[model samples]
Target: MRIARTVGMVMAGGMAMALAACASVVGSTESEVQIRTNPDNAHCDLSGYEGFAASVETPAAISIPNVAAPVTVTCRAPGFRPTSYTLNASADGWIWGNSALFLASGGGVAILGALVDESRAAGKSYAEEVHYQLSPDRPRPVRARSRDGGTDLNLQAR
Candidate 1:
């Protein structure tokens, strides 16, 4: 009788552990955040009112593994304005199939930020001044120049 009771306790513990592992695996699946931009390509000049840009489905503002109902995302850009909408999905153990849309301008801003940093580090006033030089041994030019007045530096290829 003692041996049987011990075996029963062990089996119950094992079952509990298995259930916990399954719960963890089910919870590990994360909710997805999708970002879509308009224009589909980069544009140099964004001064006109016709030009549109924006960001949608920002992951920072929302929560993952959402137990509640679906969430809505709304944003605006220069040409495009703010609009509100709702997303509907069943409250299942896993929340899947989510989407959002935005004007293309937000991504352009991000690209512009990176370009600005590159220009600053390369000592170039404009991005165009930075160019590549090639040699016989090295097919690619690894140096950049300053269009305006600034120090020039040589970049080495990896």
Candidate 2:
């Protein structure tokens, strides 16, 4: 009876560790996000949790850390008004799955696993793509239909 109890404890511990390691093993703490703007070549600044800060040109892909904190992205262009957007974090699916598994298993070890997963960096994720539409500071150039059915830019300032 004593040996059976010890074996059971060991198995439970191992299972807990495996489950707890799911996020760290199969998930990532950082993900790549594509940043884009209506007019390309705009400069952008990203700032938020963990002192995360980076600058990139528009139409670029960058790897960013994942945290359950709001990230602000500010973009600027030569003739456009500066624009900023907030990137909100969402809880990772693994957290829910881990918790569900723990509840299904009906063990304290599973509870620990769920907690471990939630407390780690794999608990949250950011959007895969972010886009911004910048309005021009000056009046937009007017477009006129040309004789050949093509469009012509009427540079006359509005």
Candidate 3:
């Protein structure tokens, strides 16, 4: 009987240590942040803007360390307007749940097993990345008119 009790206690201690290790491994206390241009409209042009700038902010920025990821950037020349958009970051790196373990036997052993299983199963982790962009708008130029029976000069801006 004493030997059985000692074995149960040792098993419980091992289970506790395993649960703690799993929790620490899955948790993400760090994150990254950066800047990038919109991949879809890369070829589009916005050369005629007066000024252009972009910025991004997030709640995790203050909480997580080393959050640096660029979403997208758009710029325009003088006489142009500004445009901006937000992007949601992906959460592929997060671990949402835990694995379960079962050990069969008596009433007292079952109760201790329940405690270990509950603690291990309750673990969770979450992470996400967000993106944003800014751009200036430029209106197309108007066509010129002809005078004095001269030829009309209409050149399309490329």
Candidate 4:
């Protein structure tokens, strides 16, 4: 019984350590995420961007920390419709590796070990690239021919 218990403890420790390293963090804490807008040079503001510059013109790159929360951004350009979008910060898939540790770690220890691993590794990250599309303030007229032959339909802009 003593030998069995000793072996179990050692196995648990090894499993925990191995699982910790398996975590594949998609992006690093200081990874730079490029932010761009279709209109270029537009003003852009990002939320939850760690300590890096939260505000910058479109076509700019900024470093953001890895976090579980999604990042939000708003972009605006002259004579263009302001646009807002969210960046997905998904949890690392290697977290599943922790599940294998349950047999060795028993219960809470496995979960705690996994959490510790994630904290030490990349926690979360915005995508490598974020792009936003903004539409012009005024809708361009569409040229359409009337069903009555040669007549053109002219719809005035509101």
- Estimate every model's Cα lDDT from 0 to 1: 0.32, 0.78, 0.36, 0.69
Better of 2 and 4 by TM-score: 2
lDDT of candidate 2 over 20-116, digit per residue (tens): 6466557777778899997899999999887989999989998888763578999999988998999876777766656665675775656676566
Per-residue accuracy of model 4 over 57-106 as CA lDDT, tens digit each: 97998876655246678899998988888776665555566666666557
lDDT of 1 by residue, 1-158 (tens): 99999999898656443333232334332234343334222111111112322333322222223322233435343344344443332333321111000122233333433343233221111111111112123334477777785868677753
lDDT minimum window of 10 residues, candidate 1: 94-103
Candidate 3, residues 58-158, lDDT tens digits: the string is 22232222122222224232333434333322323222222232232223433453444334321221134333343445445557667776877775542
Q: How many backbone clashes does candidate 3 have?
A: 18
Q: Candidate 4: where are CA atoms >4 Å away?
A: 1-31, 49-53, 117-123, 139-158
TM-score of each: 0.32, 0.75, 0.32, 0.63
Between candidates 3 and 4, the one scoring higher on lDDT is: 4
Best model per lDDT = 2
Evaluation by TM-score, superior candidate among 3 and 4:
4
Q: What shift in Å separates residue 151 of candidate 1 from its native position after superposition?
A: 70
**Candidate 3 or 2, higher TM-score:** 2
Clashing pairs in 1: 38-104, 53-105, 54-103, 54-105, 133-141
Count of clashes, each model:
5, 0, 18, 1
